[model samples]
Every structure is written in structure tokens, then in C-alpha cells.
Target: MATDVSNELDRADNVGRIVDSLDSRRVLLGALGLVGFVGLWWAGSTAQPEYILPSPLAVGLAAQSELASGTMQAALFNSVLHWLPGTVVGTTLGIATGVALGWSRFLDEALTPIVRVLRPVPPLALIGFAIAWFGIGHAGAAFIIAIGAFWINFYAAYGGVEGVSEDLLDVARSLGVQRQLGLIRTVVLPASLPEITTGIRTGIGRCWMLVVAAEIFGAPGIGRQIFRASNSLQVDRVIAYILVLSVMFLLVDTAFRVVQRRVLAWR
Candidate 1:
């Protein structure tokens, strides 16, 4: 028993060491890559005029000016307001529908073909229809964003549910947990959580993409700012907005990762 305990402790120590090593490696590699990218950008910018390709400092100054003017904040908030509601509603509905379809062959067969037909059509392709139907406002942008978020989440939830182990189902049955709802609650949900989390992450990314497109096409948001900057030949401001969007995406991705780690701690 003492030997077994010692071995277990040694194994745990090895795992901790491995995790630490990997974390350090990742940080080092990421920093190196970032430095290379910045060096390249600086070199390229220096090779051209500010109007052609602004220096990083120039772009930073432009961003600061926009922030000080409050236009950047207003545009960012508008985009977020449009995106948040649609993403929440669409993701929730998609997950619920996906779970139901995955759990029932009859439902899956009925809906799969329809979804397949709709899924291939890009959200941007439907913008004209959105404008006509919802009229180039928050509603239209939200609708477009929802469409993008829905498909990603639906497939993720479906795949996750379908991937649950048959042995888990059998074990639940053997334990006299005979109700379908009980099985879903006790076994299916827990088993499929990781995949669902992945889908939500993907959906969030899609929402960002859609927000830019929606704003570019007459919706009031950051994409509009980008569009205006481009049209007016304010390349530095355009690049600044792009940088801001990229930063937002990074922050959202990090937030999701933290939430996933906490929520799926058992895994």
C-alpha cells in the first residue's frame, strides 16, 4: 500500500511538471511569434508612406484620437448591443433544437435536409433580404448575426449529443433511471458538455464576423466606422478599428476559455 501511494504521488508530480513545462513553452512561443509579427509590420510600414501603410505608432495615435472623440466607443457599443441579444437567443434556440434532434431520429430526419439547404447560404448573401424584411437597422443586423450564430451552435450541439457513450446510457438504464428526461439530465448533458462548449466558442466567433459585415452594409456599428474610414482614405483609422476588433475577439475568446475551464472542471 505504501509503494502504491508513493507511485501515485510520483505520477501526480510528473503530470504537474508536464503541465508547467507545456505552459512555459506556449508562452515563450507566443511571445516570439508576436515579436516577429511586430518586426515585420514595422519593416513593411517603414518601406511605405503613412498614407500607403501607417506605422504602428501612427495607427496607435489614430486609435487614441478616435477613443478620445468618443466615436469609437459609440460604434463599439452599438455593435455589441446588436450582437449580444441575437447571439444569446440564437445560440440558446440552436442548442435546444440540436439536443432534441440528436436525441430523436424522427426529428433529425425531418429537419436535417432543411437545415442542410439553409446552411450553405452565407449570412452576407441574405443581407438584401434582411434589409427588405427588417430594414437596415438593429433588427436586420441582429437577424443576420443570429443566422451565423445559430448554424455553428446547432451542429456542435447535435454532434456533442450524438457523441455521448452508449455504455453511459446502458448504465443509466441498469440503475433503474428509466425516464428519458432523467437520462438526458443525468447522463447526456454531462457527457456532451465539452462539445457544446466548443460550439458556443465557434458561435461567438461567427457573431463577430457577422457584426462587421452587418455594420459595413448600413448598420450602425464598428463596421460602419471601418467603411467610412476606408471611403475617406483614412487608412490608419481603418487599421486601428481592425486592431480594436481583433483585440475584442481575443478578449472574448480568453473569457470563454476561462468559463469553459471552470464550468467543465470535472473533465
Candidate 2:
């Protein structure tokens, strides 16, 4: 028994080492792939006009300058102002509305056609309405962002609720949980959490992209920074601003993933 235990311990240690080695290899390969991409981008930049394809070094320098001057910070702050309220409002409304429709057969039949008809309308088309309704400030930009988030979250919640197991719900009803609200609160929400969380994650990313489009008019954000840079043919600055958006997205997504893992730990 002692010898058998020793052999199992050795095997486990060997497996752990092998897993660590694989993880390190994956990290190294990812680094090399990023280097190769930068090399190709440098070659492309050399072949094209600087105004069209600024070199990575030049873009890095521009990013440094923007950071030193505090312009990027200001733009990022403005963007957050637009992004937060819009995402929250849209997400809350969408989830609530979708849950209602999904829970009620009568509402689903009566409202789904309207949803289908409205779903095809792009957020860009509503830019005019946003401006007219909220003016050309943060509210207007947020309206556009909200619209984009609304549809994404709406579909997610609707699908999640729709996909809840009938057997599970029936079991809950038989257990003296016949109230619709009680069933939804205790059973449906938990069952559909994964889909709802996925929708929320997707909406978060989508909303960031919309920030640029939302600020295209007169709103002050990273999108406006890009516009100003492009007008002067400041390709390096444009690329730098784009990198800023990429970095922000990565940071936010990473933070959210941590929360998601905790929330879904039971799974």
C-alpha cells in the first residue's frame, strides 16, 4: 500500500509538470505570434504612405505623447460617461421586458412580431432620432449606445427564459411554488443565468464599439479624437487612439470575466 501510494504521488507530480510546461509553451507561442504580426505591420507601413499606414513605432510614440498631454485620459473619461448609463439603462430594461415576454405566452405572441420588425433597424439609423430627442451631448451618444445594447440583451434574456426546462418548472409548481413570480425568481432566473450573462458580456463589448460611432457627431470621446486626428492626416495618432480603445476593451473584458467566473462558480 505504501509503494502504491508513492507511485500515484509520482504520477501526479509528473502530470502537473507536464501541464505547466504546456502552459508556458502556449504563452511563448502567443508572444512570438504577436511579434510576427508587428513585423508584418512594419513591412506594410514601409510599403505604403505614412498617412495611410503609420509604423508601429510611430503609433507608439503618438500614444506616449497623447498620454503625456492627458488628452487620452479626458477622452476615455468622456466615453465612460456615455457608455455606463446607456449600458445600464438598456440592459435593465431589456432584461425585464424580455423576461416578461418570455414568461407570458399571450405577451410573446402579441409582442414578438413588433420585436421582429424593430430588430432589423440599425442603431445608426436612429442617430437622427437620438440627436433630436437628446441633443448632441452625452445623452445623445448614450441613446445610440443604449439602442445597440437593448437589442443584444433583449434577445439574450428572451432566449434564456424560453429555453428554461418545462420539467423543472413543473417540479417547482408541484412543490408549492405555483406563483409565477416565485417560479421565475427561484427557478427560471437560475436556469437561464448562463445565457443572460453571455448576453451581458456581449453587450458590454458591443457598447464599447458603439461609443466611437455614438460620438461621431459633436460628442467628445475617443471617437472624436480619431476624427480630429484623421482630419489632419495624423495616421499615427489615429492608430494610437485605436490602440487605446483596444486596451480599454481588453481591461474591461478581463475584469468582467473574473466576475463572471465567480458568479457561475456553481457550474
Candidate 3:
């Protein structure tokens, strides 16, 4: 029995090693792919006139200059400030509303029709309304971002809550968990955490996309900076802002993944 247990343990160790090796290989390959893509971009841009496409080196230098002068910092701060509050408020409201709608059949039925009617309208389509309501400032940009984040969280939370097993519900009810709030807190919320996290992640990505568009319209952020750069024919600066935005999103995505792992540890 001792020998058998030792053999099983060795096999398990080998499997773990193999999995780690595969993960490392994936990371290595992804890095290589990104490097190759940048190389190709650099080469293509170098082959073209500066007016048409700025070389990666030029863009990198511009980005460095922007950072050194603190313009990049200010733009990044402005963008984050607009995005954070909007995301927080929209996500909170969406989750609460979604929980209510999913838990109550009558509420779902009543709201579903309205949501359906409004859901198809793109956030960009409401830019005019946002501007009219909030004026041309941070609030308008935030409103646009919020609109995008809200729908994402709403649908994700609703689906997650609706997906909870009826058997689980019955079990909870039998175990003296008959209170709706208690059931939601103990069972539904925990069960739906994974989906809710996914929705939040998606919303984060969407918020970034919308922020640029919102800024282009009238909001003061990275998007506005990029737009100004483009209008002034500063191709390198424009590319630099685009690269900065990409890096910011990557960092945000990594943070979200970390949070998801911690919050859903039970899973």
C-alpha cells in the first residue's frame, strides 16, 4: 500500500509539472506573438511616410515625452476619474436591479419589456442626450460610460441569478432559508459570483471603448487628447495615446482577474 501511494503521488506531481510547463509555454508564445506584431508594425510604419503612419520608435519617443512632461499622466487620471465613478454606480445599480428582477417574476416581466426596448440603443446613440443632460464635461463622459457598463452588468447578473438551480432553491427553503433576502445572500449571490465577475470584466472593457468615443464627442480625457493629436496631424502622439490606452486596459484586466480569483475562491 505504501508503494502504491508513493507511485500515485509521483504521478500527481508529474501531472502538476506538466500543467505548469504548458502554462509557461503559453505565456512565452503569447509574448513572442506580441513582439512579432510590434516588429511588423514598426517595419510597416517605417516603410511608409511619416505623414501616413508614424514608426513605432517615433510613437514610443512621443509617449516617453508625454510621460516626462506629465501630459500622459493628466490624461490617464482624467480618463480613470470619469470611468471609475460611472462604472461603480452603474454596476451597483445594475446588480441590485438584476437581483430584484431575477428574484421576482412580476418585476422581471414588467422590466423585461422596457429593458428590451432600451437595450438595443447604442450608448453612442445617447451621446447627445448625455451632453444635453450633463453638459460637455466629465459628467457627460461618465454618463456615456455608465450606460455601457449598466447593460453589461444588468444582463450578466440577471442571467446568473436566473441560472441558479431550482433544486438548490428547494434545498435552501427546506433548511429554514425561506426569507427572500436570506436566500439571496446565502445562496443566490454566492452562486452567481462567477457570472457577475465575468460581466464586470466585460463592462470594464466596454467602458474603455466608450470613454474614447465619449471624449471624442466633448468629454475631456485621453480620447480628447487623441482627437486633438489627430486633428493637429501629430500621428506619433496619436499612436502613443492609443498604445497607452491599450496598456491601461491590460493592467485593468489583470487586476480584475486577480479580484475574480480572490472573490470566487470557493469555486
Candidate 4:
């Protein structure tokens, strides 16, 4: 037992070391990529008018100005307002429905057809209804965001739970856990959690992508700000806001990864 524990610790240490090395490489590569991208932008701007394509320096300056003006902060707040609620509602509902469908034959039979029909239609395609119902504000944007996230997590949870091994359930049954609900809690959920978490990660990224389109209607957000800047021919502000969106997504995704690693630590 002592030897086994030692071996396990050694293996964990090695995995940790490898992960650290990979993270370092990722950081270095990301920095190099950013530098190359900026260099290209600088070159492009030098060749063209600022209005057409702002240089990296011009964008940086505009970003600083936006920060000082606090308009960007307000936009960020508005974006998060819808994004947070939409993601939460969508993920919660998706998990519940997915777990139900995966566990219960009746639910699967009842909802599968409806889900199939709805799944292929992009959430943005429902923008007309969203605007008509919610009148193009934060609620409308959030509704659209929720629709996108719902399907992502829904499929992830459904497939993940359905994929849990029958052998695990058999063993649990032998141990006197008979009810599907109890079995779900004891075996299925934990076994399938990695996939569920992956769905969450995907949902988050999807919501970010949809937030832009969601705000196309008069909703106040970074996406709308990007649209406004573009209309005014303020290419620098548009680029700056686009960078802001990227940074926001990066931060949120990184946070989710941390939580996911902790949740999946049993693996």
C-alpha cells in the first residue's frame, strides 16, 4: 500500500510538471502570436488610412481613452448583466432536462423530437421573435444568449449521462441503490461530470459569441459598442472593444478551467 501511494504521488508530480511546462509554452506562444498580429496591424495601418485600419498604437490609445471615459466600463457591465443571467438560466435548465432525458425513457421519447427540430435552427434565427417579445433590450439579448447556451449544455449533458457505463449502475444496484434518482446521484453524475463541465465551457464561449449578435438590436453591451464604433468609422474604438471582448472571454474561460480541474480531480 505504501509503495502504491508513493507511485501515485510520483505520477501526480510528473503530471503536474508536464502541465506547468505546457502552460509556459502556451503563454510564450500566445505572446508571440499577439506580437506578430500587432506587427501586421502596424504595417497595415502604415500602408492605409487610420480610418480604414487603425494601427495597434492607435487602437491602444483609443482603448486607454475609452477606459478613461468609463463608457467602456458601462458597456462591460451591460454585457455581463445579460451574459451572467442567460448563461446561468440556460445551463441550469439544460442540465435538468438533459439528465431527465438521459435517465427516463418517457422523457426521452417525449422531448427528443421537439429538441431535434429546435436544435438545428441557430439561436440567432429567432432574433425576430426575441425583438418582438422583449423589444430589443437586455432581456431580448439575454433570451437569445440563453437559447444558444441551452442547446450546447443540453446535448453535452444528454450524451454524457447516456454514455455512463451500465456496469457502474449494475454494481450500484447490487449495493442496494435502486432508484434511478439515487443512481444518478451516486454514479452517473460523477462519471459524466467531465462532459457536463466541457459543455459549460463551450456554453460560456458560445454565449460570448452570441452576445455580439444578441446586442445587435439596441441592447447596451460591448457588442453594441463595437457596432456603434464601426458605424461612426471609429475603427480604433471598434478594435479596442473587440480586444476587450477577447480579454473578457479569456478571463472567464480560464476561471472555468480552474473550476473544471478541481471538479474532475478524482480522475
TM for every model, in the order presented, reads 0.93, 0.90, 0.92, 0.95
Candidates in descending TM-score order:
4, 1, 3, 2
TM-score of candidate 1 on Cα atoms, chains taken together: 0.93
In angstroms, the error of model 3 at 211 is: 1.0
- Tell me the tens digit of each residue's lDDT in model 2 across 1-267: 999999998998999899999999999999999999999999999999989999999999999999999999999999999999999988888888888898899999999889989999988789899999999989999999998889888989999999999999999999899789999999988898888888888999999999999998889999999999999999999999988888888898889889988999787
Question: What would the per-residue lDDT of candidate 1 be over residues 202-245, giving only the tens digit for each residue?
Answer: 99988987888987578898999999999888999999999878
Of 1 and 2, the candidate ranking higher by lDDT = 2
TM-score of predicted structure 2: 0.90
Clashes of each: 0, 0, 0, 0
The residue-level lDDT of candidate 1 at 255 comes to 100
Error of 2 at 182 (Å): 0.8
Estimate the overall C-alpha local distance difference test score of candidate 4. 0.92
Better of 2 and 3 by lDDT: 2
Residue pairs clashing, model 4: none
Please give, for residues 17-65, the per-residue lDDT of candidate 3 as tens digits. Answer: 9999999999999999999999998889878998688888898899999
Give, for candidate 3, the lowest lDDT window spanning 10 residues: 213-222
